[model samples]
Target: MELMGSMSVVEELREHYVAVVGSEPEYHEMRTRSGESVGVFEWPKGTSRMGVHLYASAGATRHGPGAREHAVELFLGVNTGSDAVKEGFANLILSVLKSNTVPQHGVFVAGNWKVIKGRKFTGWVLTERPDDLIPKLQLADGRHVVFLDALPVFPEEASYRRGNRSDELFEIWEESGLKSWDLDRDLPSVIERRSILRWPSWAQRNG
Candidate 1:
């Protein structure tokens, strides 16, 4: 096994996944419109699939020189390995890298997106990794890469997160007893309709 610091970022991440999940992942290649490509490493976990972006932090814009101490690699969990799901994450990561905004924890990027057909997830929350299975990775250059879970969210859930607190929405998901983050899971918004009434008039009207 290659030691830490000696391995490339992708190699280090692959090793971490192997160590934690005890299996090799299937590599899905995603190409940007500019012809650049990134690998989405996916692993099968029972009825679900977990994917990690291998190049989200390898650049110097978003996670490289611009934000070394706060670098993040995005990951997602879904009910199936849908191409649309992978594309959604890839597009989000690339979009962030190309924009002035840095991906921040507890923030949800809202859009009219359906990661998987027949599902109602309209955006994703950039939250801390669901578990400690994949720990922080330090590169040879001394920059550390943190993993974040790109949890799919409904519009109402996004509103709930914005109006209330991110953790409050997380708590509701925890109480939901459902796979809240799974893109293919047909999960309803856990935020009660009455809760929307407490938000601003704009939010109430929209949500």
Candidate 2:
């Protein structure tokens, strides 16, 4: 979606918050879910570009917290195809929630399949805080869908860690000084330190 459309969604949600809560609630651009920095937005500035992490959170939240209450949860499949579609859908859902008013309480958005012996589903729900709500978004039949009752958690720092393969790649690249200074035998450690700089814009959106 376009930037204007995303801003409109944020504006609509802000209006809904004011209408229901009887006051203008604060709007924050969460940089990292578990970090202390959630960038607050001043209305009229317009919505910032949506990133991949925020997009994923939106999808996870769809089924976890958006669809349920106290014990909100979300489910996802353990495959690549589902992951790609779900990621796109999450972005769409975030766009929708930005414009639409959430129902009084809980809601749900289902997915193609469930993992973890059905203990977790592909979608998410919305509820209270301190509880990591799963928010999810998906696209189906040309329609964008979100599955969370409340806003999805966006973080200010790295939430999920990279895999060993990624680490190895970083180590090799750092030793070559392609992206940073050479630190002798500290190459490995330096690589680990500098790896954080490689996170995509979408991944670091909240910060």
Model 1, span 9-58: residue lDDT tens: 56766776666556667756566555655556766555122343222222
Candidate 1 positional error at 105, Å = 2.8
Give the runs in model 1 whose Cα sits over 4 Å from its true position.
1-7, 34-36, 46-67, 100-102, 161-164, 181-207
Q: Pick the candidate with the highest lDDT.
A: 1
The residue-by-residue lDDT of candidate 2 on 1-207, one tens digit each, is 221223433454345334433344334344322231221222121221211122222122122213322211122212122233333333334433333444322333223232112122232223232232323222222223332322221111012122313234334544655421111122233333312222222222221
Q: What C-alpha lDDT do the candidate models reach, one value each?
A: 0.55, 0.28
| C-alpha RMSD of each candidate structure in angstroms | 7.9, 17.1
- Predicted structure 1: lDDT: 0.55
Worst 10 residues of 1 by lDDT: 196-205
Q: Which segments of candidate 2 are over 4 A away from where they belong?
A: 2-4, 30-147, 150-207
